[model samples]
Target: MGEVKAIKGADWKLEIGGLTELMGEKEGPALLFDRIQDYPPGFRILTNVFRTQKRAALSLRLDPNLSGIDLLNGWRMKLRTFKPVPVSVVEGGPLFENSMSDGEIDLERFPAPIWHEMDGGRYLGTGCCVITRDPESGRVNVGTYRCMIQGKNKVSVKVNKGKGGRIAMEKYHQAGQPCPVAISLGQEPSLFLASMSPLSPEINEYEYAGWLQGAPFPVVPGPLTGLPLPATAEIVLEGEIPPLESKDLPKEGPFGEWYGYFADTTVGEVPLMVVKKVYYRNDPIILGVPPLKPPNHYVSVPLGAAALWDQLEQAGIPDVKGVWGFVYSAQTGPFTVIAIRQRYAGHSKQALLVASGARAGAYGGKFMVVVDDDVDITNPYDVIWAMSTRCNVREGVDLVKGVWTSPAEPAIPPASRSPRGYTMDRVLIDACRPYQWLDEFPQVNVFPKEYKRDLEKKWKL
Candidate 1:
């Protein structure tokens, strides 16, 4: 397989206008470009980093057949043996190839796509991480947040409630000081993966990225924010968030979000980032990832599945053979299916309990199905078979309502603005033949291996 190409700013163009326009029409790995009217021509915009299972496997250095949980397990194992090294400043690097400062800084020059027609403005940063630090604890946090370009040197940043950046911003707000921040764009795939992972509080994503990379990530402290960033990153934007009351208000977001539709109209005052500096290597590459409906390339199903498995494991769920997030159901976003080797009478129910509370399963999922070890959770056909024959809706279905939910989810009623927890229904199917009734269920008809081989050898048709 050919190695993936790295995008640089000097040779890239920003052509597409909105996220819907760019993502809705593309069928496969899409390279969007036409060049901005003012910026240099021939620049490229790359999206859909892991468009196929093969690509996702390659990104994690695993076989395509491996489950998402398998990849996470592999990384966790490697992490045990890895240590991160700080990035040293080199004499010259690609990020330094182009420099923009003061009057030269013009965010509009780049073709930053307006992700959705309803979105407030052009979003410059999606596939990027904003690094910040707690003023008191000195611990660092890296999080994925949407940023909109407001001017040549300003941006409107949305940090979701309860996120790490929001907490950091609050600390600064209380003290009446600007919160320092650094945004890193166009980083390595592992770094991007780590940024999206749910790490423990105060755990630097750079170190996690280093663990994933099998070496320390190169880092350079931002001049203004002093936040550490990937040295090999295509672009870096250093800035600070002013106090909430002092910040300017911007109309933000009708943007189509991960929920498969334009998010509900919401108006709020967000932070305004005054860019202190912008850094890029020669021909720096800017990355854009647009979220559309399910079955889309950027769908969060795989990640959600992996997270579910992790959560189950953490919760001490036993005999788990595998876990899968069903892509077909729109209500659940992803239906979690688990196959477990039965060790007790209610083993399947135990598995369902763990799954329902599992991080990925709890947040986005609405349905849960548990099957005997004989069924392959990864294969939808096999799971459906168990559900059809072995599951009893009245007896097997377990529903738990009033669970915690997020505002991002559309299922919540309008009256409930606070996080609402809905009931989860779990079904356990006994696919295995009854232990005491071997004679009750007749054996399936099948030709012997030798006979099958001979038949194939003799038949030319």
Candidate 2:
């Protein structure tokens, strides 16, 4: 349950060999490989930090039962009293255990796993954050865009349209300057979570990570780009994005996404990075968690749901009990379900409208379901039952068409790609007992607590 602070370089081979075996056996522990082939033996790598709910809870220093939303809300509440104390520079950290210069860089040496067969290449920066700057504002940005190892020093970066990274790149493009960027490969779990957190466009994620960690994160200004990065990061790559050219298209994904299928794409392309420098600790351990179908604990949907809840609450939506973004649907397309304690007539409808209009909802979500507070939104069966029995589809469903959609979404039609959103048919189910005639509905049967306990004891024989 404790974090591995550092590992010795000489012991790296044993650690990697052991970790590789453990990963194959599905054993539990954060694998920190001190070394991999070609790199100095002391470089560190981490994996399986978010493999289970318990692990995620532990990482956040929360009770096991606390959901990501609960943790986020608790952290948000502390924000009023918390302050970020940025670390400018320090004497040394694990990341500086070994450093490589321009000519010494070799990306293939790291144990960057070939996670999924369909992935375009070994993703070197899946669990990392790409730090960039807004050329005009001089404001820094951090994004969780995935990166694929392209060469000895280069990696392909996928910055989705409308994402902060892409916008920053656009700013650089407009200025006719190569975008200054730094890619951080590994660091504290809090930083990774903050990277994925849906913060205000103006909020620096580094500051947010500091708030969550209960202290300002230790950061070092990137050597070349000057972007703040996790000081303890395993690997840091300082680079620039060249003005995007028409012929720079690199075949990108066929990676199995959260939707349980290979993400559909005929022309998969993203911006490419020509590495100017690559730095690492001696034996660097690259973290890689390939997206699969639902139940991938590190999957983006659940995290997105937590962000959605925060956004909905911020929008003054009342009685919003919970939110669940279907991980299975994210790969297929974005679908979300929200649970609320309906306060009055049309409350559910109002909730639906606000959620659908939210920034995250408009970006990827295709379907939304609003259910009464009693229905556990996380339980698909409960949500389905509510939709089936309580909803009168014709009366309850509301559709909004021509909504804004992200270009990365596969379901979006080409003709409607001009900031256009598709229709979202919202089904509001009043799972609560009918207010006018509560007694008319049949009472649900359940075993008495004492009787169930007795039965369980007797069945042991």
Candidate 3:
């Protein structure tokens, strides 16, 4: 509902993704593409929907005026008040306007964009939620996983190991049954945000989305799979992932990842699903959220860091002023910074160590920096300045080996990677002034904000 720039005649090949990447780099408005090359006018694609804080705040139902760390802090506070608001089930809704089943299911009818030039194929679901229920617990999980269209009614879902959906799918496969799944290709913003959050396994994303919007999320059961589908979703697919041996799994990825690299593709590692049904509203829109290079994140703010902030407090780290991350998504990434009011001699280091191992901060992390409260962790220049001025490399830096990481880590040699797990090293930097010499530490050289304001007012020159 924010700034939308509607355009026409963009090819689904590189044109659409190229424009989306270009607009994101410019920090422009959300793009709505219509009259795509070789497609009818009604099949649309929306991209760059969260390129600004104001837009992200609106989607999260928070104060739109907030920005930077204040916006993230507002979300952190809102998360503290979270209580499950169950979804509302309805008999039917707009999502059923068009339906196809079995032989009639043709995924190519929709506009799936080849987001990156070297991407293995056209990704049908990026800003999409893949819904799967745990076979044992029976608790449903909604998560965002890249889905690449492979055939008329087939797509490869890259649900990584240890993810909720992957774990649930494995459970069903082990029991010798195909894992039932329903994917919403485009839905309400709140649901999309919830799907992308780093929630605990016990938390249901639908209930979380309801809480985010301050009302019940409306859903309709998928006629084929019985999974709850967003009543107002633009497009929905009901399918099942069958048990496939390593040799049977399909190749997936080589798509650009959040870390700004086209990681190697799997030969036969990603799960492939056969779509049993397809449903869509008239004039359906696909939410395309292709990953761009660093600094141009999928979301404007480092939202995942909010979860880490809470994790630090839960771990009993005192005086944490704020937390921020660069190249971050779902709370894990390459660089993270924690601002704190150093309380003891080892306070900064303790914060660093705990954060480097905490569930919310450990995964896929590379550089962990801790700074005094005076340093603004959200600003790269400020954080780097603190590290340069305050850190004594020999005394302030520490490296932890074989830490938790993701498969997308470009630095991990392919030969070293194994199906069992992946690990990477972490560099922790204490940017806070030496606590023992607090009384004698050199003060920062900068003009006070109030002093500068008063000077500007007096010198109306």
Task: Write one digit per residue (lDDT tens) for candidate 2, span 254-345.
Answer: 55554555553424257778787777765565664445455544532265565567678888888788877665322213667888876666
How many angstroms is residue 45 displaced in model 3 relative to the true structure, after the best TM-score fit? 0.5
Residue range 405-449, candidate 1, lDDT tens digits = 344566556676432123333333445434444357555465777
Query: What residue pairs clash in candidate 2, if any at all?
Result: 9-42, 42-283, 43-282, 43-283, 43-284, 44-285, 45-285, 259-331, 402-421, 403-421
Q: In terms of lDDT, which candidate is strongest? A: 3
lDDT of 1 at 199: 60
Indicate the residue-level lDDT of 156 in model 2: 78
Q: Which scores higher on TM-score, 2 or 3? A: 3
- Whole-structure CA lDDT of model 3: 0.91
Q: Write the per-residue lDDT of candidate 3 for residues 1-461, one digit (tens) a residue.
A: 54899989999999999999999998899999999999999999999899888898888888999999999999999999999999999989999999999999889999999999899898999999999999888899999999998899999998888789999999999999999999999999999999998899888999999999999999988888888899999999999998988898777878988899998588778889999999999999999988889888889998889999999999999999999998887874889999999888899999999999988888889999999998888889999999999999989999999887888889999799776668999999999999999889987789998999999999973
Q: Per-candidate TM vs. native? A: 0.80, 0.82, 0.98
Tell me the number of clashing residue pairs for each predicted model.
Answer: 31, 10, 0
How many collisions between residues are there in candidate 2?
10
Q: What is the C-alpha RMSD of each candidate to the true structure, in Å?
A: 5.0, 5.0, 1.2
Q: List candidate 2 segments past 4 Å from native.
A: 1-45, 65-88, 264-268, 299-301, 328-333, 405-410, 413-442, 445-461
Off by over 4 Å in 1: 1-27, 30-38, 64-93, 102-104, 245-248, 299-301, 327-334, 418-461
Q: Give the number of the best model, judged by TM-score.
A: 3
